[model samples]
Target: MVEFERLANEKASEYAYRYLKKNIVGLGFAPNSKICESDIAKKLGLSRTPVREALLELVKNKLVVVYPQRGSFVSKIDYDLVEESRFVRLVLEKAIIDIVCDKPDNRFLEKLEINIRNQKYYLDKENKMNLMQLDNEFHKILFEMANKLQTHELVESISGHFDRLRNLSINTIKDIKTVSDHEKIFEAIKSCDSVKAKELMEIHLSRHKFEEKILREKYSDYFD
Candidate 1:
């Protein structure tokens, strides 16, 4: 893996957190891989203090495992946590959609459209990561328009475990399902069909059941 370099003048802990989190979530650092603080600090041209703090933050997020007098490593995919995140996301998104249905904003609709356009652009180019980023932006826009940005942030804070699965399988259900589902959700919102939009959101996010199971099996080594 290529060593990541941070921008000049940034705090080491935050930079390390972002750096390590990206690698872990993007599958650059395989699950259960040893996280040598000394090695990473050396690679990043930093000292162990900031790296240690960063790893502790990751530990609280369940993204890193630390064993006293042993070592630290990346945490494996925990299905129970994924299910919990799914529940949390479903509830918050459903509530948000219901609120949005009361009065949909044209500017928000335009934002979602632009995001979809970018999704298609990156999808056509076979850029899975970029497409997934747009997918996230679409939902972020949804919550923003619904005036529930804080709720969305709260959901995201606890979704690292589930996002690992989503990122792993983004290519599996990219265009055929994910983007199409977003389009359908948009149509429902435009028509002011709150019920339909909420149901579709449930289906869209919950549709990953089978895919997630398959990913867990295929990447057995990556799961607890």
Candidate 2:
């Protein structure tokens, strides 16, 4: 019985983490909103212990912060962290592009083209959530092509924050521009033009700084 209880608690903790991440990333839980472990426990029909464990995991991910006596709250967007993540992504992606360029694998290109087709299908269906997931998958496939699985996983972990910011940016006219930018990147990669691919990626990643600035100004209330 005790072992069963332990296993249940572990599963509950994982569920809590997923719930919190989805709500936070979806902006259902606004930034700096007080998150009570007991409340979450009650809502999920679970014990407070598992909820606490889940909250601890979120804190470790820098998604939430715990106060001594007050409670836990979602963390504000950290621009520095965003910039750092962008830099790390650029370096890793550029290295991958170099590998692909040197090898010029048809298999990689075919897989990427298939991903793009899937993305278009989702877009046509107006499935925003699936589109977002597929878009991330597209990038992940690219990194996998270069055999940077670990690096891709690291990026995937923090990608939720970037996605949230990107959601806001896509609301603007710049979203259309982004499609063109992506096309250019794809063209460079497909042509095995490593230099052009790297240049396009640099431009693509740097554009996020502008988007971040716009989002901050537009949604100043959401940030600290």
Candidate 3:
């Protein structure tokens, strides 16, 4: 079930959107599962209007599908879209790596180190969701250091399908090397090694492709 946590200052629709998107991306509402606006509205203690608006926004992001007669459903993961997202993110992140390598910041480096440490802690505890969130924060900090948060948001907007696959991977794959991968990337950045950083980023971003066959065979219902 999708859980809701109300935000004190956010509007109803904004709150609904964030809650719904998180659940969808996290696979709480599995791919292609039906979504009932009234049910969601009731669950969130909001009216249908805000929930409907939120659903419309999700539809725009390709995270939700609406059928004329059947109603709304969570969008299935689309491998092609995931590929395109990876390509776009790789290009942008490589650029970010170049910026970071040219002028590494001690402040951000420390933050990255802390993020990695926390990731390792969560990894030891086998807390996949927390590890996943930390993994995202590690990359987000890189963009923040590069002064390209807007670009990161743009990537995120188009990367919903990729995000779903990533969440699924974190949950289903036991031998996730994300922490190690982050360590390597962090070392490259800390050493101001643009060449190595870009290389590692490419390999890291492309990791999903290697898992495609296994994931598809195991969870055929999750993908389009």
CA RMSD per model (angstroms): 2.2, 5.0, 1.2
lDDT of 3: 0.92
lDDT of 3 by residue, 142-210 (tens): 999999999999988998999899988887777887899999999999999999999999999888988
As a TM-score, model 1 comes out at 0.90
- Model 1, 131-206: lDDT tens digits are 7678889999989998888988898889888888887778555445778889999999999998999899999887
- For model 2, what is the alpha-carbon lDDT of residue 154? 89
lDDT of 2 at 55: 88
Flag the better candidate by lDDT, 1 or 3. Answer: 3
The lDDT of each candidate is 0.85, 0.74, 0.92
**Segments of candidate 3 deviating more than 4 angstroms:** 1-4
**lDDT of each residue in 28-133, candidate 2, tens digit only:** 6877888988888887778999889888988887889888888899887777666777878888889888987887678877877777767666554543656656
- Model 3, C-alpha of 43: deviation from truth (Å): 0.8
Clashes of each: 0, 0, 0
| Candidate 3 weakest ten by summed lDDT | 1-10
Model with the higher TM-score, candidate 1 or 2: 1
Could you tell me every candidate's TM-score relative to the true structure? Answer: 0.90, 0.82, 0.96
